[model samples]
Every structure is written in C-alpha cells, then in structure tokens.
Target: MRLSQSLIPTIKEVPSEAQIASHRLMLRAGLVRQTSAGIYAWLPAGLRLLNNIADIVREEQDAAGAQEVLMPTIQPATLWQESGRYEDYGKEMLRIKDRHERDMLYGPTNEEMITDLYRQSVKSYKELPQVAYQIQWKFRDEVRPRFGVMRGREFYMKDAYSFDIDYEGAFVTYRRMMLAYMRTFQRLGVKAIPMVADTGPIGGDLSHEFIILAPTGESQVFYDAAFEDVDYGAANFDSAKPDDLGRFFGIMTDNYAATEEKHDLDVWGKIDDSRKREGRGIEIGHIFYFGTKYSKAMNFAVTGPDGQKLFPEMGSYGIGVSRMAGALIEASHDEAGIIWPDSVAPFKAAILNLKQGDPTTDALCEDLYGKLRKVALYDDRSERAGVKFADADLMGHPWQIIIGPRGAANGLVELKRRATGEREELSLDAALAKIGLNAS
Candidate 1:
C-alpha cells in the first residue's frame, strides 16, 4: 500500500483524551478514529491489523476443534428472558423495540443466543461435545467507556459455546479452549498469564481471565515465573484424553497466578521468592466452564444413552478481538510509537524512498514495492526524510527499508528492525534476505 494515497491520517501530537499508551498511539498512528464516546471507525491500517488478529484467533480455535459460525449482532430479548437474565443483565444490555413492538437487544455477549441455537437442533447424546464459535461484533453500553477499544461500547469478539453431556465433558472442553487461548496469545506475541477470575455476567464457578503483563495495566497481578518458560507450540497437551486435559488444567490452576480481586497472600507467601513474578496485567481473553447453567434454565435437553432426558452442560469462551490490537500496543510499544510484532503487524515492512523524486531512489523503491506490494507499505510521498521516518516508526512496521540516492545507486539500502531498533547497511539483496524476501 502506498502511503502517498493511503487513509492513514497520522497526527503529530497526542490526543488529550487518550489516557494510556495504546489509546494515544492508536490515535497518533491514525489506526482508528473515534466516532463517539465508545465507538470507533478502524482506518485502513487498523482494519488490516484487526483482520490479522482475527485470522490467528480463528486458526487456533479451529485447531482446537471449535467449529466456526457467524452470529448476528442483534439478538432477541426473549432468549435472555428464557435464561432469567433479561432484567438481571442490567442497563449495559442495549434493550430495543422494533416496529412490531417486539423486545430485542444489541448483544453484549452470545451466551443466551448460542444456547438457544443449540436447543433448537441436535437432540440426543450423539451430538454431544460440540463446540461452535463466532468472530463477530458485540456491544455493551459501558457507563464510562474509556481507554479506547479496551473499554469500548462496540467491539469485535470471538465468543464460542461448548455443549457437552456432562460435567466431565464440559471440563475437557474448557481445557481445550484454554490450550487454544494460550497458543493464540503466544502467536499474537504477548505473554498472557491465565489468572483465576470472576465470571461476572457470564455466571460460572470455573473461570479464568487471561491477562498480559504491561506497565500501565489496570490491575496488579502476581504469577509464577515458571509460566514464562511453558511453550504452548511445543509440548502437546492432547485435549481428547481426560488425563492429559486434567494435567494441563491442573498445572494452569496450580500456578500462583491471580489478580488483586482473587489474590491470596498466604498462597503467595508459600512460593519461593525467586519464582514469584509480579506486574500489572491487562485482561486479554477469558474462558469459562459453567455446567448446565443455560441449558437448565432454557429447558435445553437431549436424550442420554440410557434414554433419559438430560441437560447438556455448556461453557462460553471469549477473546476481545478488537481490544487485542490495542492490547498489543500496550504490551509492546516504546517512546516513539507502537512496536508491532511481525506476526500481527499491518504491513510486513515500510519501503522509504528517502529522496522520492530522485531517479535512483524512485526506481529502487518502485522495484522493491512491486516485488513486495502484497506485504509492503511503500512511503512514496513527497515529504521530508524526518517526517517519513517518524511516521514509519509510529506505524511500527516490523522493518523499514530505507532507499536514498547514494544508497540506491550503489545497490545498497538501510534496514532497521522496529522492535530491536537494529540497523544494518547492506546490499539490496541482503536486506531482502533479512526480511525473508527470496522471490523477485
């Protein structure tokens, strides 16, 4: 994408309303524009990042055997009523009335709706152990919506529902989702610690809120340093076997990881000082294991193997898909701007034509851009070197390939890694090799 004609309306100064690094950088980088108190319009760069995050979230969920299904943003209020949470959900639920005077709402979460879908179809125990998820937009009118997308009224979410025949099945599903969450965050390039958390509106005794450590996080957290070395990509935990899943779940819960709300100093004291790790953390995702909570209230029943009617155990897992883009910045940014991890960066690299009009620089940039247009963000604007360099850093492409008249003529260009601030002067071929551009 060419910045000369892109919609990335980057600003020189930070907005006063942005309280955190993520919100401030998001505004200055022109990733998103606020339309209202808690509503935002994701610009080109922001949308690309959002989609990238969503794609990875989808991949991990699928890998964990969760089938994808797109759900609607608008839901009928009757579903909530059937679950006895119509009035209990409070004003955060955007209650509405259509022209026909039927009660409805913009769903904050899909627990009730997904449960309703399950009950309508799939009878008998044979359909048990089904997990379905959706990557969709959700809304909850926050009383004080601040901190940009992290606490927004409207946001994208990956909410999945699991239906099982019994508590044992639901527990296994919970761990499967847990494994999926860990891998997802691992790929997203953040060390998200799973902490015991309150289920809140979702309503479940077994719940965990995955929190990523950040200097400017909302809540203080205490965790074990052992969590740092556990590799999700390696060491497979077979979710199919009860014993394997049980062991995985045990390790996660046994670790001394908790937020201020659930912290126990007695438990914290037992851990060795060397193993104790403490920091502020931002909640990235959540998983729950609520057995028969919705199925019982909504009268969702299926026939058991013994021909007896039984309520299917259910659980809900959620990831704040839109909030993740903001969280990534919070977890990984410097004084200049966001330091996007390559796996989720909007663009792979930014090709800077330092002297745009110079024939040598122009030709070199054009050739590089043509070779990498699919993954490169080309800065071809007629701007000063300072302005272009600053904007490139603010956007935080994983790499910046600088081409000047002198360097272009010599078949050499400068390469800078955004995360490490490492710069190398090398031939164009060497620069391409560093960014893994072997073709063309």
Candidate 2:
C-alpha cells in the first residue's frame, strides 16, 4: 500500500483520555477512532491487524474440528427467557423493544441462541459431537468502559459452542479446545497460561481463562514458573488417541495456576520458593464446560443409544478478537510505539523513499514495491525523512527498508528490524533475500 494516499491519520501528541501505553499508541498510530464511550471504528491499519488475528483464531478452531458459522448481533429476548437468564443477567444486557412491543436485545453472548438453534434441528446422537463457532460483534454496556478496546462495551469476539451426548464426550471436546487455544497464542508470539477461573455470569462448574502476564493488566495471577517454558506446539496432540488426550489433560492439570478470584493461599505455600510466581495478567480467552445448563433449560435433547431422551452436555469457548489488539500492544510495545508480532503486523515491511523527489530513490522504491506486493508498504508521501522514519516505527511494521539517493548511488540500502532495532546495509538483492516474500 502507498502511504501517499492512505487514510492513516496519525497524530503527534497522545490523547489525555488514554491511560495506558497501548491505548495511547493505538490513537497516535491512527489504528482506531472512538465512536462512543467504548465503541470504536477500526481504521484501515487496525482492520488489517484485526483480520489477521481473526484468521489465526479461525485456523485454530478449524484444526480442533469446529465449524464456523455467523450469528446475528440482535437476538430475540425470548431465548434468554427460555434459559431463565433474562432476569438473572443484569444491567449489562442491552435490553430493547421492537415495534410489536416484543423484548429484544443486542446479545452479550450466544449460549441461549445457539441452544435454541441446536434444539430446533438436531434430534439424535448421530450429530452428538458437533461444534459451531462464529466471529461477530458483542455488546455488554459496561458501566465504566475504559482502557480503549481492552475493556470496550462493544467488541468483536470468537465464540464457539460444542455439543456432546454425555459428560465424558463433552470433556474430550473441552480438552481439544484447550490444546487449540494454547497453540493459537503460541503462533501469535505470546505465551498465554491457562489458569482456573470463575465463570461469573456464564455459570459452569469447569472453566479456564487463558491469560498473558503484563504489568498493567487487570487480573492478578499466581502460577508455577515452569508454565512459562512449556511448549504446547511440541506436544503431539494431532495423532493422540482418546487415552492420550486424558494423559495430556492430566499433565497440564497437575501444574498450579489460578487467578486471584480462585487462588488458594494453602496451595501457594505448598510450592517451593523457586516454583512460585505471582504477577498481573490479561484475560484473552476462556473455555467452559457447562454440562446441561443451556440444553436442559432450552429443551435441547438427543436420543441415547439406549433409546432414552437426554439433554446434551455442552460447553462454550470464547476469544476476545478485538481486545487482543490491545493485549498484544501491552505485552510487546516500547517507548517509540507498538512492537507488533511479525505474524500479525499489518505490513511486513515499510519501504521508505527517504528522498522521495529524487529520481533514483523513487525508481528503487517503486521497483521494490512492485516486486514485493504482498508484504511491502511503499511510503511515497512527500514528508520529511525524519517524519517518515518516525511514522514507520509508530505504525509497527516488522521491518523498514530505507532508500536514499546516496544509498541508491552506492548500490546499497538500509534494512532495519522493528522488534530488535537492528540495522544492516546491503545490496538491493541481498536486502530482498534477507526479507523473503513471506518474511512477516
């Protein structure tokens, strides 16, 4: 993309309302603009990052055997009433009335709606183990929405529902989801620890919150230090048998980890000093096994092998797709701006024509831009060299390739890595070799 005609409206000073580094950087980098108290309009640059994160989430969900589907943002309140949560779910629920005076709501979650959908069509154990997921906007109407997208009232989410005939089957499905979440975070260049968590309004007996340690995070967490080094990707889950799933579950559960709401002082004291670690963490994803909570309430039943009708055991998994943008910035930013992970950076590299008007520099940048269409951003703006360099850093592309008259004359250009702040002078061919077609 060429910055000369792009819609990135970057600013020089931080907004007073932004309280954290990620929030400030997001504003200054022109990634998003606030539409209301907690609602935002994602600009071109931010939307690119959002789509990348959603792609990762979809890939992981598909690998775990979940099929993707789209659900409506506005749902009839009758479903919530059927689940006996219409009165239970408090003010956060954005209740409304339609022309016929029927109760309607902007869904905060989709348990009730998904249960109603399943009950209407699925009638037997033949479809016993099915998982459906959707990526859509959700609203909670937070009383004090703040911290940008991190705690926004309106945000995007990836929510999946799993249905099984019995408790044992449901547990296996839950384990698959847990492993998938771990791998998803790892691929996004973040280490997220799974900690036992309170389900809150989403009632359930079993729940786990995937959290990443950050000093400015809202949740306090305690865990074994060994969790920091565990590699979920290396675990052989793809070819594992049913029994192997049980073993993997046991190995992960044997470790100690919990959020402050579920933390136990006795368990913390039992661990050796070297193994104990406490820190603040941001909650990025959550999974829960709610047995027949939604199915029974909404009359979602399937016939068992013995010819008896039974409510299907069910579970839900959620990832805050929009909130992850803020979480990533919180975990990986420096004084200059966000240090985006290469996997999710909007552009792999920014090709800055330091002397834009110079014929040699222009020709070199244009050539490089044409050759690397998929992974390059050509900065052809008529801005000062210093301004262009600062904007490139603030935008957080993984690399910056600078071309100037002097460098072009000498058959050399500069390549700089955003994360490490390392630079190298190399020939045009060598520079392209260093950052291949799919470098990001």
Candidate 3:
C-alpha cells in the first residue's frame, strides 16, 4: 500500500478529548475516527489490526473445541425477561420498540439468547459439553462514554457460552476456556495474568479476569513474578484431559494475583520478597462458571443418561476485541507513538523512499515494495524525509526500510526496528532476511 494513495489520515495535533495515551495515539495515528460521542468508525489500518486480533482469538477458541456461530446484535427483550433481568439490567441497555411495539434491545451480552439457542437444539445428554462463540459488535449506552474505544458505547467482542450436563463437565469446560484465554493472550504478544474477580451481573460464584499490565491501567494489581516464567505456548497441558486442566488450574490459582479491590495484605506479606510483583493492569477478558443459572431461569432441560431431566450447567467467557487495541497501546507505546507487537501490527514493515524523485532511491524502494507489497506500506509521497520519518514512527510499523540516494547507490538499505530505535545499513538481501522476508 502506498501512503500517497492510502487512507491513513495521521494528524499532527492530538485531540483534546483523548484522556489516555492509547486514545490520543489512536486518533493521531489514524486508527479510528469518532463518529459520535462514544462511537467510532475504524479506518483501514485500525480494522486490519482488529481483524488480526479476532483471528487469533478465533483460532484459539477453535482449538479449545468451541464452535463459531453468528448471533444477532438486536435481541428480543423476552430473552432477558425470561432470565428475570429485563427490568433489573439497569439503564446501560439500549431498549427499543419495533414497528408492532415489540420490546427489543441491542444486546450487551448474549447469555440469555445463547441459552435459548442451546435449549432449542439439544434435547439429550448426547450433545453435552458444547461451546459456542461469536465475534460481533455489541452496544451498551454508557452514561458517560469516554476513553476512546476503551470505554466506548459500541465495541467488538468475542463472547463464548458453554453448556455441560453436570458440574464436573462444566468445570472441565471452564478450565479449557481458561487455557484457551491464556494461549490467546500469549499469542497476541501480551502478558495477561488471571486473577480472582467478582462476577458482576454475569451471576457466577466462580470467576476470573485476565488483566494485562500497563502503566496507565485503571487498577493497581499485585501478582507473583512466577507467572512470568510460565511459557503458555510450550506448556504440556491438554485441554481434553481433566488431569492436565486440573494442574493448569492449580498453577494459576497457586499464584497470588489480585486487583487492588481484592488484594489481601496478609497474603501479600507471605510471599517471597523477590517473587513479589506489582503493577497497574487493564482487564482484557473475563470467564465465569454460572452453573444452571440461565438453564434454570429459562426452563432449559435435557434428559440425562439415566433418563432424568436436568438443567445443563453453564459458563460464559468474554474478551474485548476492540478494547484490546487500547490496552495494547497502553502497555507497549512510548512518547512518540504506538510500538505495535508484530503479531497484531497492521503492516509488517514500511518502505520509505527518502528521496522520492531520485532515480536510484525510487528504483530501490519500488523493487522492495513490489517484493513485500502484501505486508508493507510504501511511502512514495512528495514529502520531506523528516515528515516521512515522523509519520512512520507515529504509524508504528515494526520495521522501516529507508531508501536514500546515498544508500541506494551503494546497494545498501537502512533498516530500523520500531520497538528499539536501532538502525543498521545492510545489503538488500540481508535487510529483507532480517525482517523475516524471503525472495518469493
């Protein structure tokens, strides 16, 4: 993609309304544009990043045996009413009436609706241990919508619901989802620690919130440094095995990790001084095991193997697909702009034609761009080198290939890594190789 022909409208001045680094950088870097007080339109680069995150979440969920399904954004009020939460759900829900005066709502969560769907299809224990998930837009009319996408009125999310025949099955599903969440965050290049959390509105006695560390986070958190040593990617745990999941759960719970609200000083003092770690953290995902809550409320039942009717145990897992963009920037950005991790970066690298009109520079940049066009951005605009550099940094591509007259003439290209302000002049092949590219 050529910047001259692209839609990345990076701004020189930060918007006054942005309160956090992520919010400010998102707008200045042309990731999103606010169409309303708390609603936004994701531009090209922003949407690409969002899709990348969603893809990883989908992959991990699939690996955990969760089937992907698309659910409606607008849900009937009857579902909430059946669950006895319609009037008590508070004002954040956007309730509406359709042509025939039927009460409807833009769903904030799909607990009731998913339960209804599950009851309609599965009539026996043969379909036990089912998990369904969807990645879709959700809305909650926040009283004071602020902080860009972080606390927006409308956002994208991945919400999964699990149904099991009994408590034991539900617990296994919960642990499986837990492992899936850890793996998902790990693949996204973020260190998300799971902590015991209150189950608000979700109505479950057992709950955990996955929080990622960031200096500008909403809450102070205390955790054990041992969490840092657990390599989730290479862990030997198997989701299908109960013993493995039990061990995984034990490892997670053995560590003392809690947000400020739940922090216990008595417990904190018992840990080894060197193992203590404290930092601010942002909540990126949550998991809850609310056994039979929805099934009992909605009269959802299936025949057991012993020919007895039973209400299926249930759980719900959620990850804020859109909020992650803000949380990621909050964790990884610097004063200049966002330093995107390679897994979720919109573009892998940028090709900068420092001397756009110079024949040698232009030729070298064009050749590199042609080779890496799918994963790169070519800055071919008639702009000064300083302007190109500033925009490149603000856009935060993982690598930048600088083509100048001097470097191009000598068959050399300057490669710079965005995370660290490190640059090296190398032969074209070596530069591409260092950037993890091939001569395909």
Candidate 4:
C-alpha cells in the first residue's frame, strides 16, 4: 500500500480525551476514531489488525471442532424472557422497542438466543457434542466506558456456545476450548494466564479468565510464577486420547491461580515467596461451564442413551476481539508508538523514500514495493525525511527500510527494526533478506 494513496489520518498531537498510552497512540497513529462516547470507527489500518486477530480466533476455534455461524445483533427480547434473564440482566442490556411496541434489544451476549436456536433443531443425542461460534459486534451500555476499545460499549467479540449431554461431556468440551485459547493467544504473541474468576452475571461455578499482565490493567491477579513459562503447544491435543486430555486438565488445575475476585488470602499465603507473584492484568478471554442454565430454562432437551429426555449441559467461551487491539498496544509499545507483534501488524515493513523526488530513491522504493505486494507499505508521500521517519515509527510496522540518494548510490539501504530500535546499513537485497522477504 502506498501512504500517499491511503487514508491514514495521522495527527501530530495527542487528543486531550485519551487517558491511556494505548488510547492516545491509537488516535495519534490514525488507527481509530471515536464516533461517540465509547463507540469507534476503525480506519483502514486498524481494520487490518482487527481482521488479523479475528482470523486467529477463527482458526483456533475451528481446530477445536467448533463450527462458525453468524447471529443477529438485534434480537427479540422474548428469548431472554424465555431464559428467565430478561429482568435479571440489569441496565447494561440495551433494551428497545420496535414500531409495533414489541420488546427488543441489541444483544449484550448470546446465551439465550443460542439456546433457543439449539432447542429448535437439535432434538436428539446424535448432535450431543457440538460447538458453534460467531464473531460479531456486541453492545453493553457501560455507565463509564473508558480505556479506548479495552472497555468500549460497542465492540467486537468471538463467542462460542457448546452443548453436551452431561457433565463428563461438558468437561471434555471445556478442555478442548482451554487448549484452543492457549494456542490462539500464543499465535498472537501474548502470554495469557488462565486464572479462576467470578462468573458474575453469567452465573456459573466453573469459570476461568485469561489475563494478560499490563501496568494499566484493571484487575489484580495472583498466580504461581511457573505459569509464565508453561507452553500449551508442547502438549499435543490433536493426538491426545480422552485419558491424556484428563491428565492435561489435572496438571493445569493443580496449579494455584486466581483473580482478585476469587483470591483467598490464607490459601495464597501458603505459597513460598519465590513462587508467588501479584500483578495488574487485563481480561482478554473468559470461559465458563454453566450446566443446564440456559438449556433447561429454554427447554433445550435431547434424549439420553438410556432413552430419557435431559437438558443438555452448556458452556460459553468469549474472547475480546476488538479489545485485543488496545490490549496489544498496552502490552507492547514504547514512547514513540505501538510495537505491533508480527502476526498482527498491518504491514510487515514500511519502505521509506527519504528523497521522494530523487530518481534513484524513487526507483529503489518502487522496485521494493512492487516485489513485496502485501508485506510492505511504500511511503511515497512528498514529506520531509524527518516527517517520514516519525510517521514510520508511529505506524509501528515491524521494520522500516530507508532509501535515499546517498544510500542508493552506495548500493545500500538503511534497515531498522521498530521494536528494538536497531538500524543497519546493508545492500538492497541484504536488507530485504533481513526483513524476511525475498528481493528476487
């Protein structure tokens, strides 16, 4: 993509309303714009990152045997009433009325609606273990939405609903999701620790909140330091039998980890000082096993092996897809701007034309840009060298390749890594190779 031809509306000064670094940087970098108090319109650059994150979530969900489905944003309130949660969900639910005066709402979550869907078609044990997921927009009228997308009233989320015949089946499904979440976060370059959490309005005894530690995070969390080094990918879930999965679950559950809402001072104090660690963390993902909560209320029943009708056990898993954009910025950024992870960066590298009018520099940048179509952003704008340098850093591409008349004359280009602030002078082919692109 060429900067001169793109719609990147970067600003020089931070917006006064942005209170956090990620919020400010996002505004200054032209990633997003606030349309209302907590609603935002994602610009082209921000949309690229959002799509990348959603793709990762989708991949992991599919790998875990979940089918993708789209659900409506506006749903009839009758569904919530059927589940007995219409009055219990409280004010955050955006209640509305259609022209005919029917109660309606923009769904804050989809438990009630998904239950109704399952009950309508899935009537037997043949479809006992099935998971359906969707990536869609959700709205919750947060009284005070702040921290940019991290706490936005309108945001994108990936929610998956699982149905099973009984507790044992539910456990199997939950373990599959746990393994999936680990892979999802790992692929996105985040170390998310799963801590026991209060289920809150969702109402469940078994729940885990995946948190990423950041200084600006909202909740306090406690866990063993050893969890920081544990890699879920090392455990092969694809080949693991039921017994192997049970053992994996035992290993994860045996560890001590809990959010502040569920923390026990006495139990936490039992751990040695070296093993204990406390920090502020952002909740990026949450999973819960609410057995028969929605199914029973909505009459979602299936025949058991013994020929008895039973309400299927249910569970829900959620990952904050839009909020992860801000969370990624919060967890990884420097004074200059965001330091995007390679997997989600909008562009792998920015090709800076230090002297746009110079024939040599122009030719070099154009050649490199043509060779690397999707992986590079060519800065062909007629701006000063310093201005281009600053914009490249602020945009947070993983690498920046600077070409000038002097460098081009000497058969060299300046290559810089955004995260490490390291620069090197190398031949054009050498620089492209270093950025993991084939110059040929």
Cα lDDT of model 1 by residue, 234-278, tens digit: 525544455755555666777789999889999899999999998
Least well predicted 10-residue stretch by lDDT in candidate 2: 244-253
Residue lDDT tens for model 4, 75-182: 999999998889999999999999999999999999998898888889789877999999999999999999899889999999999999889999889988987898
Q: Each candidate's TM vs. the true structure?
A: 0.97, 0.96, 0.98, 0.96
Q: lDDT per residue, candidate 2, 1-440, as tens digits?
A: 88888888889898999998889999999999999999999998899999999999999899888999898999999999999999999999999999999999999999999998888889889877999999999999999999999999999999999999989899889989998888889888887889887788999899999998787788888988767766677655667566756555665577899889889999889999999998888999999999999998988898888899989999999999999999999998887888999889988889999997898888888888887867677899989999998999899999899999999988899999999999999988888778775322
Give all candidates' CA lDDT scores. 0.90, 0.89, 0.92, 0.89
Scored against the true structure, residue 93 in model 2 reaches a CA lDDT of 96
Could you say which candidate leads in lDDT? 3
Total backbone clashes of model 1?
0
TM-score of 3: 0.98
Q: What alpha-carbon RMSD in Å does predicted model 1 have with respect to the real structure? A: 1.4
Better structure of 2 and 3 per lDDT: 3
Which has the higher TM-score value, candidate number 1 or candidate number 2? 1
List runs of model 3 lying over 4 Å from the truth. 236-246
TM-score-better candidate, 3 vs 4? 3
